[model samples]
Target: MKKKNVISVVVTVVAVIVAVYTLFPFYLVLMNSFKNANDIVASPVSFTGVNVTQWITNLSNVINNSNFNFWYAFGTSLAITVISLILLALFGSMAAWVICRNKTKWSTAIYMTFIASMIIPFQVVMLPLISTFRDVGEFIGVSMLQSIPGIVFAYCGFGGAMTVFILTGFIKNIPYELEEAANIDGCSPEGIFFRVIFPLLKPVITTVTILNGMWIWNDYLLPSLMLGQNGRVKTLPVAVQAFVGSYVKQWDLILSAALLAIVPMIIIFLFAQKQIMHGMVEGAIK
Candidate 1:
């Protein structure tokens, strides 16, 4: 009993220490966001010494001084993310259902293909992907590079593996009886999918949405590659990178930009947190 108690105590201490270590960087960024460059440089550790006016002034400087069009970029990012989520959730869940329900050789093969793609690093495929998109766009006589829709297409492809993986497990837990009932009630496969299974998959969908939303929101490489040098269609992550330059770096503006970039994601997660928690619970039970 004493040995077990000692082990438990040690584990608890380690967990708390790890948690604090992981969270400290975020806390530092949050607190320093309200400070000017001088205050941030002078007392990086002091959270309470921030001059609210200076913080506000720095923030305003970022807001007022930025050359990138805010509304346009913001709208582009928002549209891409939303469209990506819709495609991911709709197609991923449907594919997962078919894979779980059918369990045929083709389904297994296709599922394995998705899983294999997930293991392949994006860096390895980046060049080929870019070339492919360029060729396709050239053939179509429309430039896909630096286009918003192209970014959405990239996200949908990249996000599919994990989304399908999660949704597959969740779909397996749902009883087949529900589908039978729907069939008896004059429901076709399409009707059953939309009316019966779709509603039941809400928790899993919510989890996928939150997970994919966070990823697509923060993704820098995919957007950078697709958007090109102009940076006109830049997302927040790419926009924040512009603050760092060889001649002069504005740490204050960079930090403020970082903070602003994360605010929307934080708000989204907070609102969807309940659904995420419930999905996790359900997944655990399954």
Candidate 2:
């Protein structure tokens, strides 16, 4: 019993050490954000002499800067993340259901394609993606570059593979018996999906949304390419880069912007962390 207790103590100490190591960077960012450039340069890690007003001033600088346009960028990021998640969840579930119910060669082929696409690195297709979007935009008489719809469309395409992959696995575990019962009630295929299958997907869908939301919110490269660095429509990450350059590399404002950009995501995780874990476990079990 004493030996087991010693082992548990060692494990607990190691876990705590790892947690602190992981969180130290975030602590440093938050700590330094409130300090001025001179203070930060003097002692980056220390919280001494920090003031609430200084933090407010730093945040104000970031928010009011014409280049960062914090509010606008925040709104843009929120819209893109929310809209993309909605579309991905709806369409991914539908696609997964179709693939699960119809176990034909075509459906199997499409599912395999989605799984295969997930393995292809984004870097391989990024340039071609840009050129393709440009050509398609020109052909369709709508600007696909540096537009909200363009970014959202890109997100749906890029995020679709993983979303379908996760949802398909969950859908496969859902018994065919429920679907058959719905059919006997004169429910059309569409009605069966909307009324029965979708409702049951709540937990797994929440899991997918949180997973995708974090990625889409923090994503820099895809948006940076779709919307140019200095474009009018900027997400939080892109705007932070522009803001830093516009300020001549002022780290104080830069860190403040970073903090602002991450606050929403942190709040979301705090609220939904339970649901996210529960959904993931439930999906895995199914």
Candidate 3:
């Protein structure tokens, strides 16, 4: 009993240490966002100069700043994230249902292919992806770079693998008799999927959506490459980068902007956190 208590204490200490380490950056940002530039520079970690009025000023400056254009970028990010999540959830569910139901060698190979792609780093293909998008855009007479549709398409493609992977697992545990019953009711394949299988996917779909929305909303590197850093089209993450100039950086406004960018995601995760956990556990077990 004494040894078990000692082990529990050690584990608790380690977990506390890791949690603090992980959240320290957010704490710093939240703390310093309420301070002015001078206060931030002097004592970023200190709470001495923090106040609601200064936080209002900082947030005001960030929101109204022409360079950041918070509202415009907010709209862009919202549109892209929403559109991408919808497409990914819909098509990913469809693909997963098909793969799970077929149970053939081809389906197995295809599922393995998606699983393998998940392990590959995005850095390896980013450059090639950009050029390919450019060429394909020109060939097809539709601009694929620095545009909403283009980014949405890219997000769907990149996000598809993990989405399909998770959804596929959940679909496997769904009884095949359900699909067969729908078919016997004179339902087409499309009808069976939409009317029957799709509705059952709500839990896992929520998981995939929340997961993908977080990534697409916060992604900087891909958006920066696809949409030029200073281009007219930009996501919130790209817009936030405008605060850092070549010679000087505004830590106060930068943190303020960072705070604004993350608040939505924070609220979402907090509200849906239970669903997120439940869906993931269900997917893994099923």
Candidate 4:
């Protein structure tokens, strides 16, 4: 009993430490966002003037400085996220269903191919992909390399593998009995998939959507490479990066932009946190 009590105490201490480590950065950002440039630069360690009025003043300056261009960047990021999620969910779920249902040698081979592709680092393919896109654009007389849809396509290709993998595990657990019943009820395979199987996978779908949505929304590297240095087509992350560069280490504006970038993510997590938790539990159980 004494040993168990000691172990529990140690575990609780470790958990608290880890929680604080994770939260401290966000706390710092929140506090810094409300502070003036000199205050942040001179005494970042000191927690000062994080009151309502300060927050409102800092946030107002950030918004005013944005000149509504923030909304455009946000909208672009959202569109890419939504489009990528839809493509991944639809194509990934279909691919997973085929792999789970059809246990043929070809299907196994195809699944393995996707898994293999997942292991190939984006860095390894980055240059080659760029060259290919450039060549394709030149040939077709349509530039895809620095376009919105181009980035969306890149996301789908890179993201589909893991989404398919997770959805497959969930689908495999979904008892073949359900599919069998649907077949007997005068339902075609496509009908059964669309009507029944897809609906049942809602929790897992929500999980994937949230996970991938966060990633795509916050992604800077891909957009940087594919979208070029054009301010007009920048995503939120790209915009924030450019904002910092333009300000040239001005803490007030930089922290304000950082805060702007963070608020949406915080809101998203807060609202969909329950769904995320439920999906995780359901996925783990099944």
- Candidate with top TM-score is 2
TM-score of every prediction relative to native: 0.82, 0.91, 0.87, 0.84
lDDT of 4: 0.82
Better of 2 and 3 by TM-score: 2
| Candidate 3 lDDT by residue in tens digits, 50-104 | 9999999999998998888899999999999999999999999999988988889
Better of 1 and 4 by lDDT: 4
**Tens digits of lDDT, candidate 2, 68-132:** 99999999998999999999999999999999899899999999999899889989999999999
Which regions of candidate 3 deviate over 4 angstroms? 1-22, 103-105, 278-286
> Model 3: how far is 222 from its true place, Å?
1.0
Question: What is the C-alpha lDDT profile of model 1 across 101-145, one tens digit per residue?
Answer: 897899999999987887898899998999999999999987777
RMSD in angstroms, candidate 3?
A: 2.9
Candidate 1 segments whose C-alpha is farther than 4 A from its true place: 1-23, 47-49, 67-71, 246-248, 274-286
**Which regions of candidate 4 fall more than 4 Å away from where they truly are?**
1-20, 47-57, 64-68, 274-286
**By descending TM-score, how would the candidates be arranged?**
2, 3, 4, 1
Q: Could you give the C-alpha RMSD of every candidate to the true structure, in order shown?
A: 3.7, 2.3, 2.9, 3.3
Error of 2 at 61 (Å): 0.5
Every candidate's lDDT:
0.80, 0.89, 0.89, 0.82
TM-score of 1: 0.82
Ordering by lDDT = 2, 3, 4, 1
